[model samples]
Target: MDLLDFARGPAINVAMAVLVFGVLWRLFALLFLGKPVDRTIPRLGTPGPFWAGLREIGRRMLPHPTFATAERFAFFNGWVFHVGLAIVVFGFRPHILFIKNLTGLSWPALPSGVIYAVGAITALSLIAALVKRITSPVQRFISTFDDYFTWVVTIAPVLTGLAAVGHVGARYETLLAIHILSIAVLLIWLPFGKLFHAFLVFLSRGQTGAFLARRGV
Candidate 1:
């Protein structure tokens, strides 16, 4: 095979392997190690059923839900950070092309400027969060090694992505290689660290909200 064909095959295979294994490992670990329903803290004043959880998520999403609190800036910043990060990670042109080529699916790509803006915002937000964790006594006390590991792992992809775009030390292809390697490291680390919370957060939020609703709190 030509160099292009050979490179494509291994790139696709490695990426697929990492994705599949990372997901499975996370699923199994959560199944085995995740705390039971009663262990989760529920939101106060929630009402019961699966809908309660849905309502909680809706409240978080909406401009003003019944459970809305006065911490408007915090909520807005957090949401913006998450949404922007998602857009950059999942809506990059190269990523879309890779997915379409490998999986026979495609999505619209974000504009380059928008993607760069999202990357910048997400990186800033992550740094702010890390600082918060270090400076806040309560957060510092609550954080475990896993939490720190998650922060590093999560930040790696963003940093590498920026480096790939900037191409500071090497050719574009070399920067891309570094970016892919960082991503691979993150995938391998995800299951073994607090990064697993990325998946568990949704389920835990839902279950906790539902339970609170049942208690009429």
Candidate 2:
């Protein structure tokens, strides 16, 4: 099959299956492996653990006062990349169509112009983040194969998407094929490494806070 046909058909299907099942399996394993019986009672007048956990999860989404100064760069760049990425992924017309096809859910998309602008900005942010990770002594020292691999996989879609949008460096069809292939790679990678944090963040935050709140902390 040609690259475009492969990217649009078998590659996408297999990648999506792997993404869905792999994520579900991992989540099930995490939930069931550490099965524990809770026998502790809450203090009188204490907030319920569930609500407290939800509160903590929401609260933690904002920068904490104690660590805000130290984490300023992370908070700023992280939000920029994440928000921009979200817009590009979920607000693009084609992506909305794909979602509608897959899940019978549809939402209005942002203008193509807006999507292009956000995508370009997100691509730059990702590149900047990669450079920082490579150059900073601390970040570089702590980097692993997964770190660099994740960076490449994450950035590929953005670059290819922009290329396809701008009709740069290749035919639009070829650029789109590359973009789709990159996304498939990203899907397959998501459940396996640091990218798992995308799924785990809410669960981790909630569980951590609930555990602490159960002890009246």
Candidate 3:
């Protein structure tokens, strides 16, 4: 039996359902339960404090012109890793096909080689980031259990994908099974962990924008 075939059937469906629900639940909770803004930070150029925070977030998201410095390299690598992982996870042909079949919506599919390359790059970048966290005193000081757990959870899918591709330590079916299982675990853990911040970030940014608008600084 094909491992990929197994993942395509009930197991994949269940995992996908859980992932969708978990993400939604966390988002809903954050939307309703998160505290209101206490104070606004002043914007550098904008008239209000809220605009400044929004601008800071935008700056953080953009790529610097050069990666000559360590900070610039880290920022670029971090963003590249996130974008690459998103493309591979959501834009791959099989994933798109599955979504089309399940939800009656279709998206453009990325090429197979590109999907694999993006996954590989994301895996490498995650590893580098984890290493930095472990070796750098500043990062280590700021790191918490959730931070390390998030790294492991985030990296597991990429590593498992590589293993499944390489047919590591077992039959392709077995490796694929492990890969699917890891994804299922990630889905369940996401809502309860720092990974939820993936969605929370946007909400936080919007809140910052709103606060700035109210202040009219």
Candidate 4:
């Protein structure tokens, strides 16, 4: 077996297995920590848990007014890379084919050149985010190993993908192998790290919103 074989086979298979198991484990852990029963009667003239929680989740997607101005850079930068990542992953023909292979789903793809350009832009956004994390005193102080580690795993695939697409730094085959391996690493680490927030953010925000909404706060 060759490098590409290893990356496309065992590495990805194990990473996906770990991803599924870890996500399920984390979710089960949260579920087991059951919410306490709410005994308080909800105040009148307010949307109940379902609507209030949904609204609050949407509301908090933006930074609070108190810090919105201060957080604008980080906020917009985050959205930039996140949206770029989505476009590259789902809009590229090869990626859509990969997803189809895994799940028997297919979608139209954007032009390869367009998706690759977006990948480059995504890489820049990630780098900008890293710089902000380092330069901002409060963010720097609050940051932990997980923060930087997650960032690396997040950016590694993007960087490697660009290299593979450009056929730079190595033979195209080798670069592609590296890119796939980086993604495998990302998948393995995602559920075990801060990256899990990709899924958890909604659960957590909705729970809080439901709790607070019951009190009409």
Query: Which candidate achieves the best TM-score against the true structure?
Result: 4
Worst 10 residues of 3 by lDDT: 40-49
**Global lDDT of model 3:** 0.77
What does candidate 1 score on TM?
Answer: 0.75
Give the Cα lDDT of each candidate.
Answer: 0.73, 0.91, 0.77, 0.92
Among residues 3 or more apart in sequence or in different chains, the pairs in candidate 2 whose N, CA or C atoms overlap within 3 Å are none
Q: What is the per-residue lDDT of model 3 for residues 177-203, given as tens digits with 9 covering 90 to 100? A: 878777777777787788877777866
Q: Write the per-residue lDDT of candidate 2 for residues 29-135, one digit (tens) a residue.
A: 99989748888886666567788779889988889999999778777889899999999999999988877888999888999999999998998898889888887
Best by lDDT: 4
Candidate 4 Cα deviation (angstroms), residue 201: 1.2
> Candidate 1 at residue 34, lDDT?
58
Better of 2 and 3 by TM-score: 2
> How close is every model to the real structure, measured as TM-score?
0.75, 0.93, 0.77, 0.96
lDDT of 1 by residue, 1-217 (tens): 5433433456546755876788787688767885555655555655556898887666556556543574454566778778877898789998788668768888888898788888988989888888877987887999999889877877777887887797767777766766766666676676667766667777777866677686675
Pairwise lDDT winner, candidates 1 and 3? 3
For model 1, the stretches where C-alpha displacement exceeds 4 angstroms are 1-19, 25-48, 60-74
TM-score of 4: 0.96
Task: Report the poorest 10 consecutive residues by lDDT, candidate 4.
Answer: 34-43
Tens digit of per-residue lDDT, candidate 4, span 1-217: 9999999999999999999999999999989987787687888788877888898899987999999998899889988999999999899888898889999999889999899899999999999999999999999999999999999999999999999989988999999999999999999999999999988998888878887887888
